[model samples]
Target chain A: MNNKNSGGSEAEDLAKAEMVRLLSIVGRDRSADAFEAIFRFYAPRIRSFMAAKTKDRQAAEELMQETMTAVWNKAGQFDPARGNVSAWIYTIARNVRIDAYRRKRPEFDMNDPAFVADDVAPADQEFQQIQEAQLLRGAMATLPEEQLDVLRRAFFDEASHSTIARDLGVPLGTVKSRIRLAFEKLRSSLEGRL
Target chain B: MNVKHHLSDEFLIEYAAGSLSEGWSLAVASHLALCPECRQRLHAMEGAAGALLDKADESANEDEAWARFKARAADIKVEEVKLEAPKATKQTVVLPEPLRSYVGGDLADLKWRALGRGAYQILIETKDKNTQVRLLRIPAGKPVPEHTHEGRELTLVLAGSFHDGEELFARGDIEEADGDLLHTPKATEGEDCICLAVTEAPLKFSSWIVRLVQPILKI
Candidate 1:
């Protein structure tokens, strides 16, 4: 476990440096080489993420490709001061995934409720966001396994509270309370930083 | 404006995780546009999601995915720059950014149909037959009949204030009601209340007369 943790941290550091380089080149020169590098580094992670949600390999591949395309097109909008590149990319991936899901479901409408316009914050606020991200990472690591399990299922499985409760063999109220407690702890741990 | 009744943490987390249905996401996103506090919280949640993605297991199709990404990257067109409209200065034109895009104009442009008493409503069309979204304008001091939801109802206060038996919901506040709860909401005196409401099913109005007209009203 110790060796695995160290290896994961090392990989994360490398990914961060690559993300910084990719953002700079894309923002300034629109360099294809840098874009390709980013595509190589992040696409696999994104594919797995999408696969988990969509549960279709072909659909996941398509969505992953679209997400990278968005990164290229919207690179100018990426403000390093506002958030790290990974967070920005994650948002793009999430939007792409949501858009894909909307396309599949005829009942979903994208027009009546439009996406929120991105608001630009002051530089200091951006710093706060970065600090808050770091604080949340540390806080997440310390969460009890039970709380983390509920959170993981909620976020990754996209399961409703009732579904989670049934799957875990717990009462509906217990599922809700566990989720609430996990969030409260996250908020409290990162209270002053945000 | 300071928003007091923000979305619950559970709702926000679901939203950030992209697990919410389109109807609920719209309500939450609309509230987010008006409330900066929730927006900040959303960003924090997104950051947390990013960390989780970082630790997610690697996919087996890395090389193939990269190749596919490169082949399509060139065909992707940059989004056209949106032309900014001249800002409207009238206080009556106070729709938030998200709603403004949907309505394509300010509040004055809406064709409000009378819905008995002093209330007016405009039903917004959507692809979701399971959910209904509408704009409600209630006259100051008028009380809506007591009602319970058949499914789920999420209301975002856009103007003025409304108070149910539980609490006061002002501008930028979101009130989520389910089938288990019943309450009568009244617009506070001094100003008419305007809200964007999204409901999964028809509301069960407690008054017999209102219930009788529910089919015609289509609320």
Candidate 2:
């Protein structure tokens, strides 16, 4: 039951199917205010993101404008049912930054996987473990109690569905479904930051 | 392509960090919105980002960036934005091949940095969200540390072949590894090996030398 790829294939199917549902939401409207809403939410963050690389605030700000303008022109490309607003915007910013970096450092080859790997450092080395744990606690606050319980078991006990079911006196299917629902809600709430 | 399968922790970390492709990030975000456990991990990762964002030295836009945003919003017409799009008739999550079934679609948000020579690592979102995805590249002859899996690990060969322990996996071959497996994958001669791995825990080094160098290798 605990196998992530175990018997709950149906749940996975449902999740995949659900994305189409969300993307429709994003594609519905492309109004100026809608653009503004998205820009307001992401522009500052995108500016910050670019600033990290350029060290020039004005340049970062200009890049942010260009990035948003691209988003405005390509808003048609977004599918809300497929992803959240934040993910879409963040992806755009990332691409913009990469392109900008490459232009600035033409010697840096974009296609070299070895080059990329050598540049990558371990993920957690930058921040202490304690701070991460603290953020997890904040995110947990948004989850419903039932979903939270299922998540706790999955993460802490590392328990499988069968084991969790046997302990909780529920069907394996129910355990899987609950876990899926909880994870879905959590991911939606924590977009760009997490 | 088991679209039903949950996204691996490593992939999720990358997605959360905004290192995936736009198309893929959309798919993963949709997936995460529906999956709770993954969400919690993502939440933890965000907390890590918050820590970094809080760092006094970290670069950011000016404090008045919000003012500029307000001006932009003011110019936007409210009525036109309220119009909505028609929803698709059927509920479906169709992804590109190989990654369709995988929980997270494609990495969308990684801000890749260049290493010396032909190497690069896109700083994907951190595991805790505080750390970052450091995708590294090695030439054909490069031999990485011989290490063991911290948990269930999935390695997909994206380009050339590399030896994992004694076995060799080429493009499209999915290698599922557990804690017992010790791996020192050397890319085949001629071409570099590009593999996408989703890991829950850190790689465990089998040699003291690798362990000593781990700190320096931190991305």
Candidate 3:
């Protein structure tokens, strides 16, 4: 991560904060103007993301529609304390995509008795919220082209490990190691920031 | 909370991507519940995923897309929508989430059928036809039947620990066994070992008795 394509600057940070603000307005006031800005910015990115995975333009548009609808309806659920707009919107997109093509993902209940909670909040978590996402995005942008390709396939395309390996004409171990390397790079870059 | 053997980043990536099926997702999510280190890793992975989403290439037909979204939004009444805050109050319970719903309650409530040699298992039903998920209880110092996996098998230690080869897997640790590996895992003599094992294919049991009852056992 030494060469973090460190182009992520104050302008980008300000733009991100603006998006978060717009989202809050959408959630709190149901402000049509704010919602319009959000829909304009995120919908295209989500459509492109879904288009790559679904490989069907019409299906992709439909999935994108469903995701935006969730964003409009569940805007209140987006807690800026936990994550930013990109993290929140992508989560909805992934869920919408999975429900359409794959089985529902199992999630652990935070209230379950067998759970360990994050009792202490991350110190200065809110103040650093914008930077935290920036650091991760910068780290990803710096990954080698090959590693980034695999990362996108696994996450955006939702391809199985074996299927990815076959499609790439590489051994299963190769694909696993590529993802491992990409994650390790990301993990270290966000070490103390998270 | 002190887990020795953690799951691979591959699983975490799959979980973050929503690519893993229900059974495998349960195992990974259960581990995250107890391992803060892994949880941090998962959080970072998610943040990185958000980064990718931000830079995704744009889509075409913009005005039409907005028109479509607005048309759909018009159908829902915002006044009727419920905005419920998630329940975040911590509780002192034994079974961690989603797993509890599957187990029907506490970890102590599960009833198991014997697999002889003091090992017992309760098969958990999943809608996924490609994978089989089960809970295994091995008495202290007892060994599970020797077997090889036809596909990948992920065993998450729910309670106690087990010795597989030279590695020791404690609670919150997941053991990933693939078709290439064949080994017997024994419970350490202290407490009965309970684990959730998810397999992509049925186990290739090395014993005739286990083989005879394969269909009845259902993996």
Superior by TM-score: candidate 2 or candidate 3: 3
Candidate that beats the other on lDDT, 1 or 3, i.e. the better one: 3
Give candidate 2's error at residue A122 in angstroms: 36
Q: Which regions of candidate 1 deviate over 4 angstroms?
A: A1-18, A103-121, B59-61, B74-92
Evaluate residue B97 in candidate 1 and report its C-alpha lDDT on the 0 to 100 scale. 56
Candidate 2 TM-score over all chains jointly: 0.34
lDDT of 3 by residue, A1-194 (tens): 22344446657667787888988888888887898888888888898889888788899889988999989888866777664788888888999988887576878765555677665566666655556677777777778888888878887888888888999999989998888888888777666454
Q: Give the alpha-carbon lDDT of every model.
A: 0.75, 0.48, 0.80
**Rank order (by lDDT, best first):** 3, 1, 2
Best first by DockQ, ranked: 3, 1, 2
Q: Report model 3's TM-score to 2 decimal places.
A: 0.91
lDDT (10s digit) by residue, model 1, range B1-219? 678888887778888877777667667877887676787777777776776776665846467666766677668777754445544344454666556656667777888999999899988766567778888999999997788888778999988899997699998889988888887899999999999998988888988999999999887
Q: lDDT per residue, candidate 2, A70-147, as tens digits?
A: 666556565433223343555456557656644210121112221111222334322322222232334455557676
Q: What's candidate 1's DockQ score? A: 0.36
- Kindly report the interface RMSD of candidate 2, rounded to 1 decimal: 14.4
Off by over 4 Å in 3: A1-7, A192-194, B59-61, B78-92, B212-216
Please give the lDDT score for candidate 2: 0.48
Chain A superposition TM-score, candidate 3: 0.88
Best candidate, DockQ:
3
